[model samples]
Target: MARGLIKAKMLPEGKEVEFEVEKPVKVSDLLKMAGLSSETAVVIRDGTPLLETDVVKPGERVEIVRVLSGGAKV
Candidate 1:
């Protein structure tokens, strides 16, 4: 199994958390493993947005940003 790192924005606290992951898995799988919902965040690798079906490689660092929508009227 390969190893990788994931930086995700945690909810409630909105803090960025770093966690390790075993690669050869899809981005969606990784999110599931991390207890994160795919609908809540997006996966980015090497400054590029990756699809849920995209495979993450070992030693790769991915960022998970929370998807925020809706804003107060100005």
Candidate 2:
């Protein structure tokens, strides 16, 4: 991990990316920085799903999982 950067790993693809966070940043904003939508993907930290409003700090680690919809018709 780079010094003073938020590290996040993308699920399925297992691609790792880093973001420079000078201050606390919202999960949704991080998702946007990764070119993803909160509705389409979820941010996870320490194996816990985080809310869009949840704040992530610099030097923190997270994972982004793409949500797949359209399973058995309800």
Top lDDT model: 2
Residue pairs whose backbone atoms clash in candidate 1? none
For model 1, how does the per-residue alpha-carbon lDDT over 1-74 read when each residue is reduced to its tens digit?
75666665554456777667665778888788767789887778767888999987655666776677568767
Q: Judging by TM-score against the true structure, name the best candidate.
A: 2
Q: Give lDDT tens digits, candidate 2, residues 1-74.
A: 23368999998689999998778889999999889999899999999999999999888899989887657877
| Residue 38, model 2: Cα distance from true site in angstroms | 0.5
Off by over 4 Å in 1: 1-22, 69-74
TM-score of every model?
0.63, 0.84
Worst 10 contiguous positions by lDDT, candidate 2:
1-10
| Pairs of colliding residues, candidate 2 | none
How close to the true structure is residue 34 of candidate 2, measured as C-alpha lDDT? 89
Per model, state how many residue pairs clash: 0, 0
